[model samples]
Target: MQAIVVIILILALLLVIFTLQNAMDITINVFFWEIKDAPLVIVLLTCLLLGYLIASFYFFPKLWKLKREYKQMIKFNSELKELHELNHKNDRKPVDDNSDPEGIELDDDDNDGSTFFKD
Candidate 1:
């Protein structure tokens, strides 16, 4: 934040110097409309602001979608973390070594290729 403040201060100083140095009046020709006696800094800064506003409007939808996707990823990450902790907790339980508690029968190689766990 301090670096940002410093950069802004430097930019402001540069702008002030530029504006003072280029204080001469100039004319702007835009298509058929001719603007007379306009300051160079005012014209340049106005164009810069208009460009910024235009670009922001053009990319607003894409920016909103990216923000939404980022939120979904955060939610998914939290849910995955909870599932991982639950699995880790289940891993520390005692084992029977005969039949698994999840209904997975061991040594039952019937070769039928059918799952016993039904929905």
Candidate 2:
């Protein structure tokens, strides 16, 4: 923050020096209007401000559209994540220990055509 303040102060000093050096009076002639004895710095600053405003106006709509699209994508992603979690939860089944009626343990790895039950 201090560095930014220093840089801003330096720029302000430079602007002051530039304004003092360019404080000459000049006449401006527009299409149907004529202005006399205008400071060169004020004219330049006004033109700069006007150009900035025009550029901002031209790009604001696109910026707003991108912001809205970004918000919609975030909402869609959250909804998809919620749906995937719900499906994952529904896919899992709880194991029941008392499912066997004969009280026998079943061996699932009996591959050699052995007995289907384990003692």
The lDDT values for all models are: 0.91, 0.92
Worst 10 residues of 1 by lDDT: 110-119
Clashing pairs in 2: none
RMSD of each: 11.7, 7.9
lDDT of 1 by residue, 1-119 (tens): 99999999999999999899888889999999999999988998899999999999999999999999999999999999999999899688776778778988767575876768742
lDDT of 2 at 39: 100
- Candidate 2 per-residue lDDT, tens place, 19-89, comes to 99999999999999999999999999999999999999999999999999999999999999999999899
- TM-score for predicted model 1 compared with the true structure: 0.62
Model 2 — which ten-residue stretch has the worst lDDT?
110-119
Total clashing pairs for each candidate: 0, 0
Query: Which structure among the candidates has the greatest lDDT?
Result: 2
Collision pairs in model 1: none
Cα lDDT for residue 57, candidate 1? 96
